[model samples]
Target chain A: MALHPYDPVAGAALRNVPLAEVDSKDRSLALSRPWQLRPSLLASIASHGILTPLRLRPKQNGLMQVVHGFRRFEAARRLGLPSIPGLVLASRNLLKLFLQALEEGRTARTLSSLENAAALRTLKYRFNVPEKRLIEEFLPLLDLKENRRTLRLHLDLAVLPDALQQALERGLENETALRLSGRPEDFQSLCCRLILSFQLGKNRQKKLVEMLDEILAAASKQEVQSVEEVWRELGCAALENRADLTPADRWKRILALLRQARYPALSRHQARFDELKAALKLPPPVRLQAPRYFEGSSLEISMTVREARQLDGLARELKRISGSQEWEELFRLL
Target chain B: MQPYKPEKVFVERAVAESVITRNVLGNLPMAQVEWIDEAGQMVDKSRRWNPSIARAKQSLVLARHPGRFFKPCPAGTTKTGRRNVCCNYFVVNFASNCHMECSYCYLQAYLNLPYMVVHANVEDLLDELGQVFSSNPRSHYRVGTGELADSLALDSLTGYSRPLVEFFAGFTNAALEFKTKSNCVENLLQLDHRGRTVVSWSINPPTVVQAEEHKTASFEQRLAAAEKCSAAGYPIVFHFDPLIHYPEWEKDYRSLVEEIFQRIPPRSVPWVSLGALRMPPRLKALVRERFPRSGLPLGELLPTEDGKLRYFKPIRVEMLSKMRAWITAASPQTRIYSCMENTDVWQKVFQSQQPPSEVELGDSLLQLL
Candidate 1:
């Protein structure tokens, strides 16, 4: 069998290192490793012990620093294991060590979008990888388009605040999070809070983000300075006192306020239409429809009939509706 | 005029032999090039392409149009006893998509191509136009290139208008119109148009342009360009289509009309069209998705008989009546007409209960030429 030159175990010794003596100073740049430990992995480590050895290198302080297997070290410490199996490497190539950790993460299915972005950043800044290679080679590794635009969006996602990153990790969509991140920093936190409080699904989160963005644009057009001002003008705080409303209901109310702010004409048209509909009070079988956007000069009245008697009944209903002044007003509105 | 700089250029192998394709490639010297054997394959591949990122990067495609280059306008007869179709109006599609983004643009729903495509086979288009023109030499034809793409938006790179203007110059029966929201008329100014080409602008109020028409020339810029065209012995036209119903719209539109007449002579402006903001039912969702901050699609819209969404009749009447009044006051000699409107709207707007015959309306516009 041929020995691979880049094997992790090549010229390295496997030994049990005390978990307390392992330093994580250089771990901040590890792209593949997640910040928070997984409960399933912790439970597995507690029951079956560490199967893979942690990759470690010696530091100037003489304490071994973790190069990979950060989760395993944390889990072992939590399990009260004084020492964990570690592979001690003599090499100090950060890029090679980071790639090795990334490979392990791929095998373990732990590398997320954030991790992918971080790896691309490390390759670009620390290792001086060309942007062309990053876009063409690294973006596809994360199932993103092999383009500079996607690369930039993923890079933007990498530096988001920790809370938003955690939310992303907990399954808020990357696109939704990206949209939220495009807002002002103050609005981003407020939006994230609303999203977390309601526990919105991906579609709802997208809608919320869109509605918030529209509100912001409207406020900007109105010369309102901040989202805080929008919130105050919209009376968003009053939603808190509606104790009977569920989170979804509260979210709906908030979205309605935003929509009203965004589309003043549509709101007014809707109110007038509702008033007209109420005034018409047509029979159950009859329906009156107006042209869309109110841009065309046509109104349609539809009705259903089963027999001659029903036809006569519909005609009488139509006559009654026609006789009402609301009919004239409706035509005038049209 | 500032030429459009596509980030990447894709040339179809079929159009590689075309002169227009070579011209486009030469114009965009720094663009990354890709060659494909079939234009359909490229179109199919672009269906999955995300324009949000690509458009931000200014990536574009230059390919040959695989289908017919010339076709009649689709604004056919409506159920409301109105001839919505413009008689004898034909479209010469030099391109498929626009680089500019308007919130209420129907192209957002109409075009599926992810990138802006300039059809490279313009010589073939001219040949087709020749056949149509010769087949009906007696009838006056209103041919336009702005149906799908903005006519002047890519004129600097494509140089399509020069040949088109020169082609129509020989014909007394045919006139070419280039409708656009762009100010790229510098190329057209130097051409021997011979009063055969009409350079028109799709204008709106400054506020509406700012809010909805993204990456487009400002209203003042468009007006200045129109004034230049008018001075350069070319007939000018104005289209105030997709007139948005917003707060202070009357004030905005009135001032817009005043500005137009104040700048360009009304005698040079032969026609002015008014079309209210209306879209198909499916376009509402697309607009909301593509332009999340746009309030244009949130108007009080209901489906009309032809399956397009439009405003209620009274709203349309009010907008058109006010526009007609303002436009007439500004320039009484400028002919005003409505596009895609029914007979009732025409009667209400023109203050004539009797609907005019389609022939009369068509002749009225033709007389301007």
Candidate 2:
């Protein structure tokens, strides 16, 4: 079979291919990059056809498979075009095809972490690329560590459910998504929805995931049978009426609940400390502070006095407070 | 003695020419060896480093000490006394991690590096210690090597204990303790320590050992090894630290104490310390993550004033007081102290809030010498 030379450098050829006849099957091996119909791009293509041709290979059927230009093909189909311009190729080399598509995609727009993971997965399973080569050669090519542990983590993220994977693509950090994936499947979906809807940043996302993990650990220790029961036990309904609260405030409340569940003793100590601090209302100038974590045996009371009169006033207040039973109880708590 | 078998050996280029490095490499012939330069680049760098899985599977690393070899132990203060009570206690860093997988081990959180690293420069460590001992002629020093790594777990591979024991033998005022849960004492048996070396075992009930201490010697094996060391004229110490509160804990602990006194003479065991189970708040998550089935973190723990989670004061007092009585009945002459315990706990357990000062403690320990 004498085939014409396909420009490997430019890697595209202009040809008319029927939109209906372009086979998008076998896309399981295509890097599963998320596609959203950007109105601007659609309108531009609608006004003046696709400037770049779709990359396609002839299938066993009469149809040609669109390998690199999924978005352009979809837009052409939406515009009711009978045929679109495409780059005709004559090879079934999956690895070569993937690299070309990835290169073109990279030049056009930045690929998300999940997109990179999908490409790595295709190279791994479809091309049978060894893990060593994938981590050392291919991952560094994608600006990732040449380490097996990190490769495995990303590959795990690639196989997550669509909603979670989409959330990861939407700006969740790889580590945060991985942490969420550690939860039970149903709980992972719920967390993914909450995280995406709330639009949490990296720090808040990490906190939410950590709080979820702590709550789950406590529930598991208590032998709670279901996630619903755990959520109910945490009184998650209280968050419903907090519509006025900002996302950070809501996250703080959720964290407080998890902290109370995880460290009941610390919570009790904090409550007691707060009560004591409120009851012992000394002068505003006299600052009283308890040790952090209540792990110390002393409370620090301080006041800056510039005059002898001020010193005597402070001394008198201290003497009066020293006789109170609250002082005794506070020290005993310490 | 169990032989040290590391999966991969990384040598710093600065120490690649040292005899200890060569000897260690020659010992582990089958381990993959690579020389890393100052930039942390391996000579034959490949993508074969699977540190996470290898660490989980107990990989070991042999490297040189990068900086100072000795560090003074922190003068950990208690509620009663905010004083430096360590009394010249120091730790030598010959190793950085342990192979044993105790569920409650703080190393899971402390060590950032996954592989067990053994610092190969023992001569440098000895030289540094000799200077300290020579400069401070009047003070008695209690030095140990088990702070970061088990003392004897890799003694057979490195032969660290022999040189350490031999070094301390010449000093009448300094003592070296090899604290471990392993039964690797064959190297110690051959050395003429002259009572300068103390072999201490971190002991627990057999059930706890089986449930929590993975890959460590069984209680019976540990006690048998302790008896062997005692017979060899080495002062013996036992530490019942992190005493867990489990079902029928009293019965278990009592039997453990009885078993210890039955096998060896109590007079030979000079020091026995009891510390109830406690951990930093951050460590609980690590424990649960590493050992999912572990119930150690699910106990009735309370936050103390020191930011550590411990059993309630009354619970700790009861546990300590009961253990004290059992040990006293078994060996009245044995001196028992509490590790990291506060003044109130010491008072409640020992009937005296004013325990011996650091010098007094040092003098009493020297009596065993």
Candidate 3:
């Protein structure tokens, strides 16, 4: 069945109705994964207050469908806010409105596949939902409790014989297929074609094995010490493992994988990721901002590449490089 | 629910002076039996700690009862017997239970047990078991000692599960399950009882293991241990009993079942049982006093004929259905059974009017032995 985005009425007049005015007895809240909350984000909202309004559209009932910022909407409600601001789009013009919404959001227009995939999940669960009659919903129909969590390396990737799935789980950018769904055929084809083709000679293979040995040893040791540490170490280890393969190779595999993933929908979500990237790229336009610490200094950043690299080599680098010209140049470029 | 009462209270704690005898008369390795030094042994049966709660009419005995009053032995079949069991099960006494309070344990209620002092003697208990199994080798006695203490709780310091592993090694007639939330299998790692000892572990989601099932090994770690046992050629079992009907049960249960199939191949899963929350009358009262914040026993508890307050049957069936669907998806070949359930639930959820006879299940298990 075809699923169009939920396009509710899009107008400034209907935007800020008190929740009391919206009759919502029969409407189910947008389906979501609860554990996906980022604590720092929540703390930011609680401290500084929500800077952006939550995006929403109307559904069958009077209920407002969360178009985006589901977590922010929830955090606001949890913070005991009386009402929240939202955008309401029409159901008939879902695809166009969704794309437009993205464009308005992601003005810069270039975003990573990872950012795109995350946007898709947020959109699927937090914004547009499949109409009930649609068979085999593209988004796994989660009843609030189910999470679209980051897949474990072993089960989602390593456990499978397919190198593609393994690559995706390791967060390797797959631009080829870039599919999120793990349909057996795509995985098998990629396994036979891409992964098998990538195997190195016996000695390089041995180095890979030795690398795996050291990583596993470190992972095991980290498992005993701290899970967060283990995760960071394994994440770095996984990236290191994937580092041997070039970006072209990674994107090729990612595209091949797009079919088994939520990535393509995300790549198409050019608007949202771009917006976030734009937000990150924009400077405070003021002198004092996120005080970075490097090389015995806790100040603003402006450093040259050499000084930055020197700072990078330092045990405490941020302070040293923060106020350097290189840092400001890097920030401006970023 | 009326506040609390100790089910099997002993006015005096039994001081068992005895040590386990090594009567290994065959090829089976005599276990490395770690005993509570005579000073720690509760030698007197006449002492106040006589723990034998009635499972139907039979009074199951315990030498020394730990004084964690209000230990609720939530009723169930798989909770008692191992393999696809057909029998009654409950905790004899709850005390400083498993040293490792696995994150997924219902024994979070067992925190009430006075921590310290391992209850020593099981020799006479073995004598009772020896009589029952010998007389009814065909009777198919299905029982487990780990429900209260992790069968191997003191296995390292006490090496308890090893002797039972050795003892039950010969009881091809009976099926003894050593259920634990702990990964401490150093004692049972070397034993040769093939299938008589159905080694099992309570499983949880990776997040739960890392978070709530505190101090216990990670889900992968536990699965690795199970895998280790399976590689050493042991048919292992997994239990999702007390399947907490929590947020993201689908994700958590899915993660668990996914890892289970990925880790322990279907051929190795001797049996897997599905259960939902159930609390004894006293446990409801006790856990509230101890874990005032523990929402488990507080929500929607009503009395059952057994004096425990469990979810209404339909609610439990719904809970089990979610679990059953996930298991069915993963390893349909693995024998899936409901623990401590009755006929109607058996028919509806598992599609069985009744579980096969205990003897039949025992025979199937022993064939592996």
Candidate 4:
């Protein structure tokens, strides 16, 4: 359903109007945010500023439907502007007008508060819109240029992890949220906790993603059925990407899963414990796993390089534990 | 008053203020009194050119610091200091200023001058070199004289390269590098072609040379100079050290690498150092504030432990991987290094696995020398 310039914007417009003095109409606000608000979009918008103005129509409720300035809208929002100038489009007119805008080389903002992959797919099929146009053009066009630095088509995909893509749906434009979608269920919560825990440096964040990519890439390239197999597959080169993650965190998680105990995905916790023990001149006794959303099925370990010493240790421990009578009864049937 | 008559020049240097010389000494190597001729050039009054004591003293007084004067270089690290990174190295400054003013240069932050400051006391400089090299003899000392000033900037006047080339000759363990953006190869070409001294050039993508690095020789001219050094039996070095992080960086770097190997055989080239465009921390804001059109993006940046903002580690890793892949394919044996980076990167891109400590790096490079 096309949003009538009368819907959200009209809803926003009439939101503050007193019932006694209110009429339903859309109004536009003129705004531009500070240049730094957009990490990589200023130049594009400035280049865009040279192109053309967005055409938003006015409704009586003082809300405006964005006909353009998708870039400018985010910029203004970043700068804390309440209302932005936008051309209002009634629900009845949005479908044809949107087609006309594209035909005229006049693109509207990528987002019109009408983002839902299911809806977009339906819209694409019904309108015969190209999938690429929806992803490469319309999506980015809808976002204010400032928010586009880290925005990509994944946010438009329904199959991505629900917990991970929540921020994108809430209009929070950040790469951290986008990256978490790829994590197994076990690490999804861990990723968010880490983002909120420490000030993650850009390099740190990039390295983590690259490490995950390397793992995924390795899995796609080879066949593996066992932990040992995964280790052998990773090779030494690919493991360096995860070198920064403490060994203890890595060890404990695999052990806890094998032991059927809850585990934590963040290795930084182990690193902290190690750091304290080191300062105190005490030996690190054992790995600690903080139970949250961790489970072995959530794991997507691959042939990317890793020392896998802990995995080896776990195998040895499993052998010793199973050798005992307490372990014998556990797997006696299997 | 035109000093070098009959020679048309785009820029000229004059005596801004001088205090070192009580009077004039007529024995200075690259200076002379001249009168203007019909071609708007300088004609020397004397038959022989000599720099007087007065001239050397004048150059010194002009270069004096108004305050404490000495601050360590922020983004300055040699292949040795940069050891365990994409390379292991360090750089030193034999001169303090440059006469050429490229709009992109950071010399203004270090020196208080518009004129070149050639260290007149060769003995004191030798003493400093002696102390450094003696203490580091077992290590390969890959040091360059291009930090505070263009290593070859004042060679025409002071003839500093002659002594430097001679100085590094005895210190077989120390690799003395003289880097420049100028084609002042005349003084350098006469050296003994010792394997120790690397005649390096700080070049950029061609159009960058024309636009930002003003008064510098063209890319083709500089490559020809490298070719000349190669023919002299001297191993030459090339640096795209300040590889600008432009929108078209991939195209620019690829073209440069292609041009270099195509023009000068990879064997004749001693090494190539590919550094991302970086500057001292102080200069970042200054450059942005002063040159509004700098247009340099915040490109995958991070602050070093030492505090210089740089291309973050992953970005650097990605950059080096691409660069090393290209170079490794192009000239497999030629040594490639990075300036002032860390050890993890060295291992990742170069496949070094285990890099030497700073001292070990110095010894290894020196042994090669």
Candidate 5:
């Protein structure tokens, strides 16, 4: 195979092609999803009439395939324009055309996360580029770290359901999305719904997914199969649909329920500690706390003294609790 | 257990003429051998090689260590610099990795060198120890060779144990322990260890052996080896370290205790150490990625103060206490202690508020003998 030096945009003749003859449905050579005609782009094209020509390659039956400018092409079609300016290239190589499309898209603006995944998926599956080449050569071209995990993540992200991708566009983190990519569809959908409804931050999003995953794994030993069943069994489904509560409160309730389900013994121990602490009747400015995870050998008691007189009451409470049964129970819990 | 037949062997040029290197190459007659200038450079160049830890174990490297061979056991202190109740132990890192792959092995996150490394300069190690021992004639030391690698996993090929056993036989102030999970005790049967060397086995229940300990000796094989070593007048020690939690762990561990006492004489065993399953945070992800079917990550593990994931305090306490009880019932005279535990755990297990110091723990083991 002889190597040819090819310029993707050089020597391309610009022509005005009728919108009816251009077939944007054939996205085999496309590096992005079918044109999402944004309002601004539509307005720009509607006023200026497609100033920049759409990139096209001639089909055998006097038809043209839109390669790079799907948005501009869609805008022209919707605006009832008869013809749009386009550049028709002579080269028929699919890989070169894909690269041309990718480079053009990249130079126009940074590709969105989905567009990056789309480019990688097309380069790998459609153009028959080896994965090693994609990871080593093309990943760097797309400003991705050259590693298999990155390649796998982007490839996985490209194949997620449209709703989940839309959720990602709505600011669902890519890292979170990659984590949810491997779960069943129902789990992914439920998680996406929760994340969107609660407007979960990055940490909360991560915690929600991890809690559900671990709960499902633990429940599987008892013959439970799905996250939905675990949710319903833990009474999280009812809390999930509790319209009376705010999204924030619902998220808190659902997360607390999941955490309890995940760590039943620890929850019980914590509840016992809370009960003992309450029974001790320590007044305000005095807090009794167990060690994190009850891993320490002793409990911690701290009193915040705002005034000199407050110290007397704190001292009294502390002295009273020193010989209390609740104190002994708290130590025993630790 | 299957013999470790590495697919390739890389020999550092500095140790190309070493006896251990020659012995290893001689045993691996069909392996592809390459002579490299430096092992560290080789490792640095291969940093990007992202092979599975198990697959990386299939390549062996025989290199000369450039650093001191002896150090204090890392378990003496937790990662947060909190003092742990260690056994005043010292470690001799004669190798860098283990051939047998355990799902929870810390070397999965500890070792940077991908290939299994055996330091070929054994005579230098012996000479350094000889110097250290002569300088401090009255101090007693309990040194182990299983800190960075299994002491006996590569014994068949390297034959490093014979010299070590024979070397420690000359000293009265230090005891050498060859801790391993392998059944390679054939070489020890013929060596005169002079009661200064103890053969320790890190044993688990049969279910754990089958499920997590991949390509290592089975429980019965380890027990039989213990019996053989005991018969040869070598003191036998067992470390039930990384005792995993499961639904029937108590039953399985009780069976393990009963079987060991039934076979080996109680007098030949010195002490047993119990450690609950704990690991650094990074190892959890590696375990999930490498051994997805493992039940290890399913346990309700929480991060302790030391930044290592462990069973909850109550669960660990219950498990360790039960293990102590079963071991004590099986061999009343045999001492039991906890490994890498804090003072609180030690006190709880022993039903005492005060715990022993490191030197006291070491001296107690000697007094038991």
Candidate 6:
């Protein structure tokens, strides 16, 4: 096989380059930044300096571009080191250098979700890789399915704002973030804020996003120029932004408002059921449960007692409840 | 309606000399045809294409079905493991995918093969059916060709109905039903069906036909075709299988029922089937993705025990009961049956009468035929 003069595997050699000559600003091939470096890594670098050499290619302007070690270079930079060891490659092929750096980046550590997007974006927009090739070749390389849908989703994630990308790194789901990426910037900001503040679980996060999307899609165009206005119109704005309420309470309130708006009939039935159950005034130990979605015409009654003596009182309460008018009203609700 | 003219056609090497292949290729003089060693590879690769399901429909495949062609109707037992009061119906799948794009088509999620396939080996299908039917002379089998594909959607190209109609005419123990949403009845108009083939249309209100049933016949076109079939001595049936619910559904469905009775003689209408809109949950996402402007996904749907989503019980009951009332008011003699519904729904819709058993229902329909 033909070999180039600046082959990264064969021709590359380690050299100590000065911090001034090494340009870390050009991160066109970087998969991740050094934003949240572990304190252990910082202490290691502080004690022993950089143990591994960074990959750098010489630019035409005579400055060495950091190719694969932004995190290590950043550690040395913060430690105030004069110079760091790096492998210098003089290849004229920028794409080859980028791929070499990508391989080295993968070998060093597992790339975060956002870093995967970054690598895909660099291959796509920067190198002008065709979508078909990305879907077939690069997606599998990045541990994703080989399909146009996966490619589009990664590309969409790559283009979101930095805050949203960081949120993805910090536990926001890829699918939920992708759904938000297509919406207007204001809407994305609002939803991201809600998601982070509430500390919602995965299911609640998905439900919140889906409910918001459905409500927005069903709104009249002229009436909903802004998502905030829709929130205000639906009476969720004040409840969500209430300072005294806990995050759980706020999420519950917002979800209730959205559910009521989205499914008026189902919510109305639920409200009536709640009212009838309240009117029944069953004993605290006894519970009356309606069927799911009121899909069936049956109701369940259960009682929890700490002692056997409580059963007599519970049975008397149940007997009284069976003859109550509210019991019939509850059945009618079903 | 625009005639289905696929941009390309893939013909498997095995079926290159089949009659259905020859007829279909002969009909499509403008299509670019490619011969492949096998159909499964090409159909499998088609799913990887961009906009997989929609793009797959732009091409057609004429291949031999490599498996059994006859099976019991899957609609009898839903995916959720709840068995409905199923008519003893059988399905003869002559095709794999449908060309007409309905927003709520189960094929969007149910079928792994995205491209439309026409099984060209009709003689094998006939021979298998002959053995099954002749072996059981006392058993009456009610079979349909519309399980996986529309019965008459590709009739002009494949000309499958002629052979099927002629074959079924020779069997006194079997009846063939050509269920479709298309008005493509020209092929069956002159066939000697001999009181064996029942031409059925899956009818909806014009509003639904316009909004959801893309690239299919209009209400008037289907009614006209049904009238023509009745005049040609074939029994006619209507299926309101997916009775979509909306604010004005009652008025629209009532008008639809009244118009059918007003035009065609109700005596010729042996039975009409009512089924509410129920689909696998995955199909809901596909419908929402394909037809964003459609209101189908916005309805009040809940997951039933069958693992398919349907309108809430009261909503379904209201829609089906009102539809049953309208049809009964139109023609008291025409029988009404619920398709894929439980005993409770049947009792409510048929009020005061007991729900029929599967054998009883199947036998009653066969007796009418």
DockQ of each: 0.16, 0.17, 0.01, 0.01, 0.66, 0.40
Winner by DockQ between candidate 4 and candidate 2: 2
Q: Which stretches of candidate 5 lie over 4 Å from their true place?
A: A1-10, A19-31, A35-51, A59-63, A74-84, A90-110, A117-164
Error of 3 at A321 (Å): 84
Question: Tens digit of lDDT per residue, candidate 2, span A123-198?
Answer: 8887899988998888888888888787888788888777677777677777777776666877776567667767
Give Cα distance to truth, residue B292, candidate 1, Å.
Answer: 12
Off by over 4 Å in 3: A1-334, B1-85, B88-96, B100-119, B210-212, B292-295, B298-305, B354-369
**Candidate 6 per-residue lDDT over residues B245-316, each given as its tens digit:** 888898899999999999889988888899999888788878877888778877777777677888877788
Better of 3 and 6 by TM-score: 6
Residue A155 in model 6: lDDT:
80
In candidate 6, which residue ranges exceed 4 Å CA deviation? A1-25, A33-55, A61-64, A69-88, A91-110, A120-156, A159-163, A221-225, A306-309, B47-51, B352-354
Could you tell me how far off, in angstroms, the CA of residue B60 lies in candidate 2 after the best superposition? 6.7
For candidate 1, write residues B1-369 as lDDT tens digits.
234688888777778877777777888888899987766775566555644633733656667776788887767555454456254567888887777878888777777666777788877888888888899888777888998889998877777777889999988878898999999988888888888898989999999999999888999889889988988989999999989987798889999999889989989988888988888867876786678778776565656656677876667788999999999988898888888877667778888876556556665676787
DockQ of 2: 0.17
Residue lDDT tens for model 2, B203-244: 999899988998889998899999999899888989899899
Q: By DockQ thresholds, what CAPRI class is model 5?
A: medium
Write one digit per residue (lDDT tens) for candidate 3, span A4-112: 2343343422255355533333222322223334688789888977776665666676566665555676666667666766655455555555555554444534433
Considering every candidate listed, which one attains the maximal lDDT? Answer: 5
Candidate 5 per-residue C-alpha lDDT over B247-282 given as tens digits, one digit per residue, 9 for 90 to 100:
999889999999999999998998989999998978
Candidate 3, which CAPRI tier? incorrect
What are the runs in model 1 whose C-alpha is more than 4 Å off?
A1-14, A28-35, A38-63, A75-159, A280-322, B1-68, B73-88, B93-125, B147-163, B180-196, B204-234, B242-248, B262-268, B276-317, B331-333, B340-364
What's the ranking of the predictions by TM-score, best on top? 5, 6, 2, 1, 4, 3
Candidate 1 DockQ score?
0.16
In model 3 chain A, where is the ten-residue run with the lowest total lDDT? A290-299
* Per-model tally of clashing residue pairs: 17, 3, 66, 70, 0, 1
Q: In angstroms, how far off is B289's CA in candidate 1?
A: 13
